[model samples]
Target: MLAIDFQHVTKRFPGVVALNDVSFNVRKGEFHSICGENGAGKSTLMKILSGVLTDYEGDFFVNGTKTGFTGTRDAESVGISIIHQELNLVEELSVAANIFLGRELRHSFFLNEAAMFAESQTLFDQLECEIHPRQNVSELRVGDQQLVEIAKALSLKSDILIMDEPTSALTETEVERLFRVIEMLRNEGVTILYISHKMEEVFRLSDRITILRDGQHVKTLNREETTPQEVTHLMVGREIELIRLGKGRQATEPVLEVSNLSLLWPGHARGWKLKDVSFTLRKGEVVGIAGLMGAGRTELLECIFGASEDLPEGRILLNGEVVNFRHPSEAKEAGIAMVTEDRKRLGLFQQMSVRENITICTLPDSVSTGIVHSRTEAAAAKKSIDELGVKTATAETAITSLSGGNQQKCIIARWLRTQPEVLLLDDPTRGVDVGAKAELYQVIDNLCKDGLAIIVTSSELPELITLCDRILVLCEGHLTGELAKKDFSEERIMELATKLAD
Candidate 1:
């Protein structure tokens, strides 16, 4: 039986046509992958199917029966579950509590902790995960948290699963575990609609591939009959063109350097989360950090910017002198800034306005004698809004009102106001739409052209390959390998990233 069927499905948002006359189908017990560029309609289609977006024009059939979901509950009731790219678990709740949140096992009006733990353990055993159900959700790593999410879905007896960029935060070992779970689901006749940017993972796990470009259905190819290069072309809508434009001929100088750089987590495993990791970033260059999740990529950036301890076990030097920063203010004063990975948790002040968010990190520049000049702040905000193209109702509008893409732009604008010589962005484009991705790329390029040294880390390999002048791979919290622009390749980087060498 056909597990999913769509005819002439379409979804639109203000200033964007998310999906246009899209038609597709997925078979029972098949692992299907949807591929597209940054602004491609892949996510839109998933949202419509998962019932996250109920307002759409189309006919959708599940199990060969026509149906339309009014909300997420409607889809979940019918054995449909979506594992979003951003985790949705309650951080303060225990694993067992999250897995059976709404439908808790109870006896005589009392929550049955034993039953919940037993049930959750069964689900974890099935997924081959080792996390305890009693553990607090906040205590688990990002990868482990994702596994909990999967267990929650399985507990629902879901027959159809939709995973959006599920492996983006997973390490290689975690990815292997996820693939094993996927294989188990397929064997049990569960249909999966998987979306990912990693070509190798797509080919390895997907039995069929659906390509979408610019919100339109492009093609559907069988796994046995198509190659990665062909699929790449279909999703890209062009030839495999790689242009390493600013390398080989560019001058290299000690733009930024760190020695014995480290950061300490008060009560964690060791005295320090980062153990003397150090490197030099040169002008007109992009240094990539290729590490598994929890390899201290974000922590390393935090340490460099003085948000965390600047001197954990080592010293930092800008130009040619040692620098110490006890706070983020000190780092900003030294001409350094960082864009955090978990934007909602660490980067953006959620209750502020878009103008305020863009202007918050730059108050000193807009202030005169401890007095904040609204006119000066507004002028600065307007310039950033125009340059970064942040779509908003007005400069005074709330930041929480903007979409995820535009909110990212505001953060970029905020850091731009500081005018730092070295900028650090941790996964700047994760979960952003394709259109916004292209715009962010242009912004990064412009920053590099202005002679600002930028260092970035992303789970997506394509972003690193296409954007970086040089890529650095890290493994197990150690610098593994360095690849110049000419030496970049997915296979080679994977080898180096998994290998240990500084």
Candidate 2:
């Protein structure tokens, strides 16, 4: 059965044509995906399908019934539900309340709290998820909250589910759980429309793929018949920068030494986020941490930044002197800076102007007589923007107005305020365009030339090969092995990644 059909659909934003006469069809019970770059109209098309955007320019059909969805409720009325890249949960509500918010069980013309909890609990059990329906939504981890979103969408009894970048924030275990749920939905005759930039996950999850470029339709292919390289070419329209094992080598002394670092998850039952992970970083060198999702790459950086917790066991040493940080401020004071994995959520305050966001972190350096020197701040902002080559009408523009790449450059500017001796970055180029990614590589290289020890975590193995002096492989919270620059290759990293317990 055909679940959805969009014929010559077009979406437009101010000064940008988001989707240009896009058309595609989705089959019932099949896992279908849309692939594109960040600004390629993938999100805009999903919004149109979910009825978040209504002023589109073409035909819309659901389940072979020609109709136009005016709003989200109308889309839902036709057995359709959507989970956005950034979830839309009410943080104050309980898990049960978020799931059955609009359609609640009533008692004598009043609310029925007990009935809601009971019903939500039943759904959780049916899905084999361990989330508590009574728990506040704010308390759940990102992975668990994503599961809650999926469960909530399923609770609507919808035959078609639209998921946008669902695995972008998920750990490997959480992704497996989601894959299981998706399989169950497919088996029960539900259609899925997935949107993502991560080609690996898309290939792993989708039955067929529909490629979109600049809001126009590209091509659709069977999952088995297509290859990642071929899919990547179709999405980007060219061969991307593969892992570059640099010709130059750095042999400087150790600038950052992490000894037996370990931190607790506090919520998980079995183990900690990092299990005694130890590594060394040297000035003029870049060390890359390679792992699957949830292999503790982000957690390791968080521990180093003092953003999560104190290293109860491990000691971080700069210039061979033991340093401990109980908070992010202390870490920043110690000349240690970390760029978070999720740039939108953790890195930037979208409402703030680019100038303010860039210079906010460097006030101490840009202050005069205890008051901020606006001139110095502006100069610093301009300098970084010019050096980073970020595209914007003006530095006074809102951070949200720029594309994903430019927004990332702004975050990079914020960190540059603290002239750090060591820099830790997590997936720095996840959503940026190719041109921006190249610019960031140059920025990183310049920093390395300035003798700053750098450590970064990335799932793109090709990136690791190109960007690092060495690559460390982590598997299930264990540091499996290290690959020197000369020995760095995708095949070797894959070997260490999959090497399990004897």
Candidate 3:
């Protein structure tokens, strides 16, 4: 029997149709994957099934009975659970508390804390995770927090699970661990509905694959019968040429140099977040940073951009001139710009228009004697939109109206407007689709040809291998190894990334 069936499912928002007459079915105990480009109906369909969008026009069946959930609680009551792409845990709560929240065991008006901790431990054990129940959710890294979310869902004992981009924030090792847990659950008769832009993950874990584009169902195919190229064609309705780095692009004169960089971490056994890290970046070359979570990848970028909480004990030189930036604005003025890792929280002004967001860093250029020049701002925004190919109705449209990939392009465009000598990008393609990622790669390549020095960090190792001229590996706050293009391999990078710090 089919574990899930959707009939004529359609969802519409204020100014857009998110899903239109989409229909598919999942056999019991099977792993089903949904693939689409950004702004496709994948998330909307999952939201409808998980009862987050109850007003959507649809008919759904769970295990053979017609059902429409009224709310998340109703969905939970019927064995439906969803782990959203953006984590849904309260940051300040303990792991145990988060797992048993709203469903706390009580003994005559007293909360059963011990029982909740025990139950949470059992769930973690099932996943073979070693997180402590008493640890604060905020204290955990993104990968660990993801595990906590999985544990919370398992505690519900849900027969059907919906995971949307679950591995988007995870390290490769953590992703492998998650795949193991998912396989175990599938063997125990749980149906999984997975959504991801990653073609490899979809191909690896899915028994059947569903494709969506522009709010409409394209097709559904068995995994064994479809290739990644075929799936990519279905997702974007076109063939995308993969981007490659220019060969023989060697580093020339150093544009930026870091010497004896070190950051002290106050609350750890290891006293430093970064220990004597040193590197040099040249004009027209892309450098990549590789590391596991908590290995100081983002922190290194933050320190370079002057956004770190604590200043490092080191020397930074730009064009052979010693410099120290007290803030990001100072760094910007010195021809250095950083596109932060967390775009939603740190990179964008969610409520502002695309034009405003793009021209925010270059406000002086758009002002004349204390008066703002709207035309100049609009023209600059339009130029960036055109250059980056940001899909939007107009420059005046809210930034949030665009998809994740376009939003990232907007962020990149914002930095490009600054015309920096050095661009620091943190996980530039974290949640982007293959088509959009290719576009971004093309942009990066063009920038490099124009002599803009770039430094990028990504969780996906293959991305670095494809885009970077050189790769630096950090392990436990230390620079363990560096690999050139000829020596690049996932196994070699992982070895360096997991090396013990001396």
Write down the lDDT of every candidate, Cα atoms only.
0.81, 0.80, 0.88
- Clashing residue pairs in all predictions, respectively, total 6, 1, 0
Off by over 4 Å in 3: 125-130, 247-250
| Top-scoring candidate (lDDT) | 3
How many backbone clashes are present in model 1? 6
Tell me, by TM-score, which candidate is best.
3
Could you tell me the TM-score of candidate 3? 0.93
Which residue pairs collide in model 2, if any? 244-466
Q: Which stretches of candidate 1 lie over 4 Å from their true place?
A: 12-16, 121-132, 224-240, 248-253, 265-271, 309-311, 348-410, 432-446, 460-502
Could you give candidate 3's per-residue lDDT for residues 55-103 as a string of tens digits?
A: 9887999999999888899999999998877567888999999998899
Stretches of candidate 2 off by over 4 Å are 27-29, 55-59, 64-66, 105-130, 204-208, 219-227, 262-277, 289-297, 309-314, 363-397, 401-406, 429-450, 458-502
Models ranked on TM-score: 3, 1, 2
TM-score of 2: 0.80
- TM per candidate: 0.81, 0.80, 0.93
Candidates 1 and 3, the one with greater lDDT: 3
